[model samples]
Target: MTVLKGARERWVRTGGTELCVAELGDPGRPVVVLVHGYPDSKEVWSEVAVRLADRFHVVLYDVRGHGRSSAPRPLRGGFTLEKLTDDFLAVVDAVSPDRPVHLVGHDWGSVQSWEFVTVERTKGRIASFTSMSGPSLDHFGHWINKRLTRPTPRRVGQLLGQGAKSWYVYLLHTPALPELAWRGPLGKRWPAILRRVEDVPGDGYPTSSLPSDAANGAWLYRDNVRTRLRRPRPDAHAHVPVQLITPLGDKFLSERLYDELEQWVPRLTRRTLSAKHWVPRTRPDRIASWITEFVTAVEVTGEPEPRATGRHAERFGGQLVLVTGAGSGIGRATAFAFAEAGARVIAVDRDPESAASTAGTARLIGAPEAWAETVDVSDEREMEKLAAKVHAEYGVLDVLVNNAGVGLSGSFFDTTSDDWRRVLDVNLWGVIHGCRLFGGRMAERGQGGHIVNTASAAAFQPSRVLPAYSTSKAAVLMLSACLRAELAGQGIGVTAICPGLVNTNITATATFVGVDAAEERRRQKRATRAYGLRNYPPEKVADAILRAVARNEAVVPVTPEARGAHALSRFAPRALRALARLQPPV
Candidate 1:
C-alpha cells in the first residue's frame, strides 16, 4: 500500500534488483523525477510530488533495498553509487524513454542524483538538477581534503562543526548495531523523533516498512561514503544546471560545506531556508514552488533560472515577504528592496490603489510573485482578517515588515488626548497588531523568520514639538526590544528601524495638535520643506531595513542624525536630555 494516493505505480528492474516507481501528472508535460533518500522510500516525496503534479510529470521511486524494492543479495556491495545511478537511469528510461527529465533529490537521494547529473553517461538524459540537504560525495571529499591540508582557523572550525553534525553518518557505518537498532526501538520511535526534532508534520508518512527500509538502506553509507570521501573523483562536476537549496538549520549538514561550490557547478543558483533537514516534508510548498519556478524557467529559456542580481538575492530569493504601508515612501521602498532580492512580495497598505501600484512595480523589479492587500494595521479586526487571508492564501511569511505609521506634532501641554490616541493607534498599536497577528503565524510555523518594526529617531531623540509622536515611536522601539528577547528562542529576529527625517510624504500628512486648520497646513508645509532640505531618500532607509533583517540587528538607526542620537542615547543620555528642551522651527 503506497502512501501516495492516485499515483500510478510501476516497477523498474536494474542491477538484479527491482525499484518501485510512482508517477503523477500528464505524461506529455515536462518530466520531473523525485528521488528519495536513505532510511526512507518513495513516500518521502509524496507531499512535494502532489504539488508539482499539476505542472509536471512528477516521478518518485524507492531506491534499491528500500520500500517495496527488493534488497540485493549480500547488501554489502549492493548500494554503491554506480548501482544507484543505474537504478535511476532504469526508472527514467522506463518512464520518459525519449525525453530528458528534470531531477530533484533530497538527502541520500540528492547524494545519488549527484552521481547521475555529474557522470557523462547520463548527461543528456538529465535536463536539470535540484538538490536539497545533500552534497555530491565527490565535492564533499574535496572539501574535507582542502581543509585538512590547509587548516586555517575558520576552515578548521567549519571542519569541526561539520564533523560533529555527521555523527550519525559515522554511526550508520557501524556494523550490525545500526541494523539491530533500526529493526527494534529506533524504527518504532523514528517518526516521533522526526516530529520532535525536525518539526516534521505528523502525517502518516515513513510508511509501515520503516524497519526493513532502515535495516536495508544502511548499505547506502557502507557501500559509498567511505570510498567516495577518501578517494573522491576530481571530475565530478555537474553537467546540468544546478539549483541548490540549503537548509540553514539542518542538524546533519553544515552550511559551510557548500563554500566555493561555484568552481564545481558553472550555472548554480543557491537558496537558503531556516529549516531543519527533511525539508521535503516540512517545507513542501516552498520546495514545490521553487522546483516549479526553476523547471519552468529552464524549460522556457533552455537554461537555468537566471540568478537575481540583487544584494542578498540568495538569502531572500523565493521567500515570502509581507510589508505594511507599502503604499508610499519607506514602506513602498522596502517592498521594492525585497522584490529586487527576488522575494515574493505582499504589498499591504490601507490605500488600495497605492498598494496595488507598489505590487505591480515589485513584479517588474524582480519579485517572482507580488500581490496587493488593503488593510488598516491599526484596525485589529481588519488586521486579523488580513493575517488569516495571507496565511491561507500566501502561506506563512518568511519576513514581515510592520512599517505602517503616522506622524503627529505639538507640545505635550498643547497635544490633546485625541491627538495622542491617533498617533499611538497608527504607530504603536499598528506594530502591536502586525506582530501579534502575523508574527504569531511565523512562530507557529516553527521555521525561523524575521520581523521589522518601523520606529523613529524621535524614539530615542526626545523633542518638545513632537511629544505624542515620540511617545508612540518610543513605545514601538521598546516593544520591538521586548519581542526580540522573547522570540529569540524561537529563531525569529525582531528589529526596530529608526529613520530620521527621510524625504517622504509623511510630514505633509502629519497632524499638528492644538493648531487651527490654517496653522496646521502652514506647519506641515514648513516641516516638509525642512525635511526636503535634508533630502535623504526613503530608499536608503529601505536598504537599511533589508540589511538589518539580513544581519538580524537589534536596533538600526537610519541616517546620520538617527545614528548620532542612538549613540548619544546609549552613552550620553544627559546630553540628549539637555538637547530635548530646544524648540524646533517647524
Candidate 2:
C-alpha cells in the first residue's frame, strides 16, 4: 500500500531497478514532478504534493533504492548521476508522455535534477525547474575552483565556511561506518533528532524503510561527489527557466553557493525562506504556493514576471502577513510595508470598507495577493471565527501584527472602570487574542514565524494624565516579553513596537474621560495638532517593525523620544518619572 492516501501508484523499470511512483490530482492538468532526496523517499513530498494536487497533476517518485523502490545489485557505482537521470526520464516518459513536466526537487533531489535540467538529452523534456537546499555540483565545482584559484581573504573565508557545513558529506563517503550507523542507531534516532533540531513535526514521516534506505543510499555519494568535483561538466547550463529557493537557516548549505547562478540559468527567480533544511515537510504550504505560482506563470505567459526587487523581497516574497487595525495609521502602513516586500497581506479591520480599501492598496503596493477581513479584535468569537477562516483559506500566517488599538486620556481618579475596560480590550486583549489564535497555528505548523505587537512609549513612561492608555500599553509590552520567552524554543519571535507620538489619526479618535462631548472634541483636536507638529509618520514605525522582525529584536522604540524614554526608563528611572509627572501640553 502507498503511504499517500488517494494516490495512484505505479512502477517504472529503469537501470535494472523498479522506481515506486505515486500520482495525484487530475491527469489532464499540467504535470508537476517532485523528486525526493537521499535517505528519504516519496513520502517527503506527500505534504507538498497534496497541496499542489488541486491545480496540477502532482507526481512523486522514490529515487532508486529508497522507499518501496528496488535497490541496485551492487551498492558501488549503482547510483551515478547518469543512471539517476535515466530514472527521471523513464518516470516522466511513462507518466507525462504527451507534455513536458515541471520539476521540483529538494536536497539531493535538487542536485540530481540540476543534472536533468542542464543535460542536452533532457532539455525539451523539462519545462521548468525549482531547486531548494541543493546546488548544482558543476556550479559548486566552479565555486570551489574560483575561491581556490583567487585565494582572496573573503573568498577563502567563504570556502572554509562551506567546507565546515559539508562535514556530513565526508562522513557519508566513509566505507562501512555510514551503513552501520544507519542500520543500527542512526536511522532509529534520525526522526527524533530532526524534531529536536529542525523543529520538524512527527507525522508518519521517516517511513519504516529508513534503515535499509539510508544504508543503500550511501552509494549516491560514493558514485558522484569526488568525480564531479574533480571534473565538472563545462556545459552545465540550464535549458529551462529556474526558480531557486534558499533556506536561510539550512545547516547543511551556504547561501553564497549560488552567487553566480545567473550565468548557468538565463531565466532565474530567487526566493529565501527563514527556515531550515527539509522544508518540504516543515513548510509545505509555502513550497506549494511558490510552485503553483511559478508553474502557472510559465504555463500562461511562457515565463515568470519579473520578481519584486523591494527590500527584503527574498525574505518576504510569497509569505502571508496579517495585520489587524490595517484600515489606517500604523496598521495600514505596516500592511503596505509587507506588500512592498512582496508578501501576501491580510488586512483586518472592524470596518469592512476600511479593510477592503487597505487590501486594495496593498495589491497596488506589490502584494502578490491581498485580502480583507472584518473583525472586532475585542470580540472573542469574532476573532476565533476569523482565525479559523484564515487558516482554512490562506494556510498558516508567516507574520501576524496585532496593531489594533484605541487611545484613552484621563487621570486615575477621573478614569471610569468602563474606560479602562474599553482601552484594555482593544489595546491589550486584542494582542492576546491574535497571539493565542494565530500564533498557536504557527507553533503547531512547527515552522518558525514572527509576531509584532504594537505597544507605545507610554508603556514605560508612567503618566498620570494618560492612566488608562498607559496601563493597557504597559500590559501589552509585558505580555510580548513573556510570550517571546515562551515561544523562543518553538522558533517563534515576538516583537514589541513602541512608537512615540506618531502623526496619525489615532489622536483624532482618542477618548477623553471626565469631559463633556464638546470638551473631548476640543482635547482631541489639540492632541492631533500636537502630534502633527511632531511629524513622526507611521511609515517609519512600519519600517521599524519589518527591521525588528528581520533582526528578531525583542523591543523596538520607533521615534527619537521613544528611544530616549526607553533608555531613561532603564538607566534613569527617576528622570523619566519626573518628566512623566510634568503636565502635558494637551
Candidate 3:
C-alpha cells in the first residue's frame, strides 16, 4: 500500500498562521522536514521521504498556498517575512511536536528555511539545516554570478534582473494569471522553465497531476518578495550548522552564492550536485542517504581511537621532499613527518613565514638541511625555476609531494573564469608541473623516485557546489593514473593520494575572478581557512603518503573514509555516491 503518511497532508495552526505539512516515516524518530520548490509541493519529496522513513521521522510539506494546503488571501498588510517565517514555525511545531527538527529545503523552500534559521524564535526549533540550491540571502549574490562559464542570456537574465523574467511571477502578482496559465499553454511552459532552472529537464515528475495547485503555488513569489518583512530582529540571527547543496547546471542560481556562508555560520558544510535545479527527484537516493549519514554523525565522547604505530625500511637520509601549501594542516604535517624520517626537506609554501616555520621545526627535529622557499604553485615559470634549483642542489628527488591547493565555495557557476583557472592551475596543473619537471630528472637517473599527488575525496567524483575545485581534482586523479601506468617500467612510482577531511588552510590562497586589484589584495591579506568536522591531523596524511611511496601503491587514500570511498568507486557506485554526498563541498 502507498504510505498513508506520504500523502497524509494537512494544515495546522500555530499562533496567527495555519500552514500545510505532509508526514512520513516514524513520528517517534528524529524529525526531518523536507521542503520543496516553486510550482512543486511536498509531494515532490514523497518518493525520497518513503526511502528515508526506515531511519527518520520524515515530514514533507508544501509551503503556504501550495498543494492541498489552504491558499489564504494576503492579509490587509500583505505577505511579509515575519508571516512566511511564522508559517514555517507552525508547520514544524505541528509535525515535530515538542522536539527540534532536521530541516532540508530546496529552491524557494530553502529561502524560507534560511529565513527561519536566522530568526530567533524558530532558529532553535531546528536541529540542523540543509539548504539545497540556496545559501544565506546576503552572501549568495557574489558566489553565483562572478565567473560563470556561460553568462546569463542577456535578454532573460537582464530583463529578469530588473525584477522578473518569469511569467509565473506575473501570474502570481496578477491575482489570477497563474491559475489561468496552469489551465492553458502556460502550464506546459512551467515544467520546461523549471527544468532549465533546476538541471533535470523532464526527468521524472508528473507535472500534469495537479495543474491548478501548481499554478496557484507560484503565488509564493509575490508573497515573499513583494511584501516587506513584518519585523526585523538584527540580533536574532545566529550561525547554526548548515549544509548547502547546489547543482552545476542550475540555470536559476549559480553555486558562487555560497562562498561567504561559511563565514556567517561557523559550523557549515557545503556540497554541489552535478545536476539540474530539480535536485530531490533527479538524485533522490544519493540525497536521502546523505541526509541519513549527516543527521546521524554524532560526536563520540570517550577515548579517541589510538594512533597507528609502524616501522618502515625506507631511508630518507638526504632525499629532498618539496611540500606545498605547507603553512598548516596536512601539508605541514606531511613535511614534518618526512623531516622526522631523516629527509633533507625543502618546505615550500605560498607564505614565506609558513615555509620558515616548517623549516624551523625540521631543524629542531635534526634534519641535516631544511630549506624554506616562498613560491606560488600556480605560476609555471616560478615552479620551473624551483625544480631546476632543487635538481642542482639535492641531485636526486626521492619524493616530490604536490600538496598545494585552493578551495572554492558555492556552485559551479558561482566561479568566475579567473577562479576556475586559478583552482585548476594549482590543484591539477601544479602536480603536472612538479612531475614533468622533476619526474623527468628522476627517470633520467634510472634509479627512480616517488611522486605523491594530493587529491581529495571530491577527486573520485564531482561536486555540484565546487565546479572549479572538483574539476581540477578530477583532472589530477586521471593524470596521476595515466602517469602511473606510463612510468611503471621506469621504476619511478606515481601515487595519487586522495585525502578525506584533513584540516588545512586552502581558502587563503584563492582569488576571485574580476575582483578589483585592491579588493583582491585585501582579500588575500585577510584570507581565512575553511574547515571540516571530522578533522584529521596533517601528520596522519603525511604518514600515509610516505607509506604509499614505500609500498609502491598506485593510490594511497589517507583515511578509512577514503579507503571506503575507493572501495565504493567500483563495487557500489550508487551507494558510494550516496556516502560521498554525506560531506559538504567547500
lDDT digits (tens) for residues 1-586 of candidate 3 = 2323435666786444456666766778888888777767676786678878888888876565666566556533333456667777777767776887788888777877787787777755887887887544434333333334346675335534423323434556776666677778866676775555443335345445357656655555665544322322334343456766665556666444555565566666545444556667665654775576556652122111121122331234335678877777777888778777666788888889989999899877756578898888888899889888888876567678888888765455657777777788888888888889888887775444778888887776545555677678878888899999988755567888898766655545555433566875555444443334455676788888878876678877777777777778868888856654554522
Q: lDDT by residue for model 1 over 1-586, one digit each (tens)?
A: 4569999989988989988888899999999999988788889898899999999999998888888899999898999999888888899999999989999999999999999999999978999999999999999999999999999999999999999989998999888999999999999999999888877777898899999999998899989999999999999888999999998778999989899889999989898876779998887878898899999998999797676688979779998999999999999999999999999999999999999999999999999899999998889999999998999998999899999999888888998878777889889899999999989988887667999999999999998888888999999999999999999866789999999989999999998878899999999999899999999999999999988887789999999999999999999999999999997775
Error of 2 at 572 (Å): 3.3
Error of 1 at 198 (Å): 2.0
Over 4 Å off, model 1:
1-3, 373-375, 380-396, 436-448, 460-465, 478-493, 517-519, 533-535, 552-554, 560-586
Clashing pairs in 1: none
Clashes of each: 0, 0, 22
Backbone clash total for model 3 is 22
Winning candidate number (lDDT): 2
In candidate 2, stretches whose alpha carbon ends up further than 4 angstroms from where it belongs are 514-519
Global fold similarity of model 1 (TM-score)? 0.90
On TM-score, the stronger of 2 and 3 is: 2
Off by over 4 Å in 3: 1-11, 14-20, 74-79, 136-179, 188-204, 207-210, 226-238, 298-586
CA-lDDT, candidates in order: 0.91, 0.93, 0.67
> What tens-digit string does per-residue lDDT give for candidate 2 at 295-338?
99999988987777778787889899999999999999999999
Which is better, 1 or 3, measured by lDDT? Answer: 1
Ranking of predictions according to lDDT: 2, 1, 3
lDDT of 2: 0.93
